[model samples]
Target: EDQVTQSPEALRLQEGESSSLNCSYTVSGLRGLFWYRQDPGKGPEFLFTLYSAGEEKEKERLKATLTKKESFLHITAPKPEDSATYLCAVQAIGSSNTGKLIFGQGTTLQVKP
Candidate 1:
């Protein structure tokens, strides 16, 4: 079974403080890794996609990178507006045709101004 684990289940940051969130996983046949940001009571919003080892993507303060067995979401100098639950998910090769994402529990971030 493909499994994902995220560290530091929750984070409290002073505004302008920078940090990185980790997403580690194991899968049968790796296809892709994804990152999303979710606000309370809202669905996740797509952030990035990593397709291979050394592959990376970034948007604004969020940057995502993938290795053979794990991925990381690096947040630089976060603001109060950046506070949200960050989710990590994966798509295993040959797992299904339905485009389902196996997700991690997520790391909730709070940036206090």
Candidate 2:
């Protein structure tokens, strides 16, 4: 079965702190891996999408990288505005051709100034 797992269910960081969030997944076949940021009571905001291993994308203080079995979100000097629940999801081209998506529980990040 395909599944996704995220580490450190919660994270606390000071105003200038930098850290990485891990998203590990297992799928029969990979279509793409996506990253999203969700604020309380709001829907997820798209961050990045990686198509294959060695692919990477960046936006502002966030950088996302992908590998064969996992992906990572690197936050550099995050600010209070960056605090949110980061979500990781994967799309698989299953035998049914439905392109099903599997999501991780997500990591809640808190940035204290």
TM-score winner = 2
Q: lDDT, candidate 2, residue 56?
A: 93
Q: Candidate 1 regions off by >4 Å?
A: 95-97
User: What is residue 111's positional error in candidate 2, in angstroms?
Assistant: 0.4
Error of 2 at 110 (Å): 0.2
RMSD of each: 1.1, 0.8
Task: Quote the positional error of residue 22 for candidate 1 in Å.
Answer: 0.5
Residue-by-residue lDDT tens digits, candidate 2, 21-44? 999999988999999999999999
Per-model TM-score versus the true fold: 0.95, 0.97
